[model samples]
Target: MPPFDPLRRRLPGGLRAEHALALTVLALVGIAEGQRLGPGGRTTPALVASWLLAMAVCGALLLRQRHPVAVGWCTVVGTGTYYLLSTVDGPLVLVPIAALYGLASSGRLQAAVTMAAVMVIGVGAGALAGTGDVNGTAVFMLTGWLIAVVALGAMWHGRMAYAEEEAALRATQERLRIARELHDVVGHNMSMINIQASAALHRLEKDPAQAESALAAIKAGSREGLRELRRTLGVLRQVDEGAPTAPTAGLARLEELIASSALAEMTVTVKKSGAHDLLPATVDLAAYRIVQESLTNAAKHSGARHVVIRLHRDDAQLRLSIEDDGHGAPPGPAGHGASGIAGMTERARALGGALTAAPRPQGGFAVHAELPLSDNKTATERSTR
Candidate 1:
């Protein structure tokens, strides 16, 4: 067995080094007082009572982190009892300041303020009522220390709150990304299957071969859709089961996307006119999703028979356009029947890119995306690391 580390050991009453140090200071103060006043200097009862109260206050510091308010109250009571019996020229004054710091840092701002006010008044009262050599200078110094502790603790609390907010924002963004993925996968496949089912019914009596082919396409699309869904969900549950994994869809699979259109009953032509190799992973995935959503929208809403997908690249940017010879708009919002346009826009914007989807002046509808290749590549590479 390895040697034990004292630092890792849990001490009784949760007394870590800081608490132990506080207790030590209290013990030293008691000794100093005993020596200074000597055995027959003051009433024995008052001296003993003062020492006991100081001990109790130091002991209460053990639970400061978990129960700051309670510890603060105990320290207050102990300080008052000690000051009433003796004077404030001792280490017992330090206890209330430490308690106030703990209280404020633990998110008890109001309680800390109240304790500060009460301690100030108690110190003044002690000076006026006690029989020791207490004076106004001691009271002023102690009050200033109390204020500084509370200020530092409040600053610490503010920093913690900011960190919590940042974490929550990141969580919200991740959830939205997941939602977009689910929508793209399920929405596109369902649209294609719906069209293929209709086509199969129409051709059943006239052309058996074509109808059977349509059914086969629907089955293939459904299976592929389920596979993609599982892959996407794997990000949430990273535990490996006995399932085959595949790389995410990118521009290289443009042909496969076109072939899958056997379910759509529409011609989807692909054209590439740029350097397609060595694209960043994130850019590739976003491009695939934009095309997928565009095709799905066309298959569902456009009464046209042909769609075109074009990919172009330059020194600084990768551009893509999906145009269909379909009815321009369906008398509603731009994203008429679905959030496909919004999802596409969000994807492009995330990678420092821009996307525009509008009706063509002469004929159909067009979706255009201009993605900054340099920015996307640099950002994606950094994130992968």
Candidate 2:
């Protein structure tokens, strides 16, 4: 069944749903008042006064959204006056009940509760005094209705608040994910270009051919970096338009990544134990980014000449290990390397996985990550296609 949306009840001529509800309440109360009096009593002063009080009580509801407490009190006073001046038993009580819901939904819980208590007491006192047409049973039922309406309103308010908070949290996480992507793309390529430029300058005096190769590598890295940057920015700019159709980077480009690291004078090796394809897209992208960031840090901070990357896939999970023969922990008190590691850890945790980076006992720095492969139905389907 479709969900219940109150806004669908809008009347003709742009009348809001609340306005319709108020008019409906007014009509029902008028009918009840007519039933209470015969045709001979139609033109009586008491009936005229009762109709006026009912209109005032129901009309106040039109402003309930803007002034809930005031409208609630107005309905309460109007209902009390109607009962005191007239001997008719009618549905005018519903007006105050609706006002109580408005008050509770507006986060005015104290005022709503106080108003409900006063209403219950007033009805009970009227029954005790043998005034009006209210009895013990009617008062009891009205009290229950008032309590239930207030509770439902409070629950609706809480649900809306929770939904808003969840949306804000998702927006925050998306921004952080984009930040990590930018850092990986820009930082890695810039480091490679800088290193290649230095190499070209140093080799220009002796080996002209090697210097030209280094310059070529710099141009290639810059071009690739610009492509990736544009792709990431595209997602940010068109977020509200629709879903982006750009393909994300994945471990399928492992060879290209390794070649880029080699251009920076680092020998990178890849070892695979099992099938490496058919992983979920999210896990694949996160794994690729982890490797890219690790390589970037190695090129920029570590004086390592060799790095080994291992990928192991079993029935349960995919494991990644990247180790570099560098001066442990990337020198200096935790700065860029620390933030990079933190970002990697966040990515893994977001995917229900785990990642750790630290200095290996024997010599260099190592990063280990584990991503589960249990929920691979969708990924498997995509891979086969």
Across residues 135-230, which tens digit of lDDT does each residue of candidate 2 receive?
Answer: 999899989998998898787667656655555655667788889999889988998999999999999999999999999999999989988888
Which residue pairs of candidate 1 clash?
none
- Candidate 2 off by > 4 Å: 1-15, 28-49, 201-208, 237-247, 330-334, 375-385
The global Cα lDDT (0 to 1) of model 2 is: 0.81
Highest lDDT scorer = 2
Each candidate: what lDDT? 0.77, 0.81
Model 1 whole-model lDDT (C-alpha atoms): 0.77
Residue lDDT tens for model 1, 37-124: 6566864666787777888888887767667688889988888777667743677767777678767765778999999999888878
